[model samples]
Target: MEINLIFKIAAVGILITILGQILKHSGREEHAFLISLAGLILVLTWILPYIYDLFVMIQDLFDL
Candidate 1:
């Protein structure tokens, strides 16, 4: 929920896009794919804790 987290995610996405483009242009499409996948996983890891916390809060609110 912090602004910096959003910035960090955006920064990672930009860096990944740049790297992927470079790799693809260099004829390393497979590596570019892996880099994109890794970037996705990295972003998910960063956001998952917040998602889990939200779910927990919702569950508590509804007494689920």
Candidate 2:
């Protein structure tokens, strides 16, 4: 819930996009694709815990 997490995610996304573009333009298209995929997975990994916590909270609230 910290403000810093938002910044971190944004920064990672921007960096990944830039890096992917650089790699692709440099002719390493495959690596660029993999880099983008890895970045997505990495971002998901960072966010998954928070998402799980939210789901747990919702379940508890609904007595599920």
Candidate 3:
């Protein structure tokens, strides 16, 4: 994990929160939900590789 990745995730979270708030205030609740979901998926994609590496390391540690 790198510092840059954490920064990127934080930026995305901030942007998504702002956007979702705007959408909700504008009565676009469904769109806000979608936007939040997209953000979650986006962040998950970004972190998926690290998650896989973690799992691999755990497996190695346990000799699984």
State which candidate has the highest TM-score.
Answer: 3
Cα lDDT listed for each candidate: 0.98, 0.93, 0.99
Model 2 pairs in collision: none
> 1 or 3: which has the higher TM-score?
3
Q: For residues 1-64, what per-residue lDDT tens digits would candidate 1 score against the true structure?
A: 9999999999999999999999999999999999999999999999999999999999999999
lDDT, model 3, position 17: 100
* Stretches > 4 Å off in candidate 2: none
Q: Candidate 1 at 46: error in angstroms?
A: 0.7
- Model 3 scores worst on lDDT over the 10 consecutive residues at 1-10
Q: Each candidate's TM vs. the true structure?
A: 0.95, 0.91, 0.98
lDDT of 3 by residue, 1-64 (tens): 9999999999999999999999999999999999999999999999999999999999999999
Candidate 1 lDDT score at position 20: 99
**Candidate 1 lDDT for residue 50:** 100
Provide the lDDT at 29 for model 3.
100
Give the candidate order by descending TM-score.
3, 1, 2
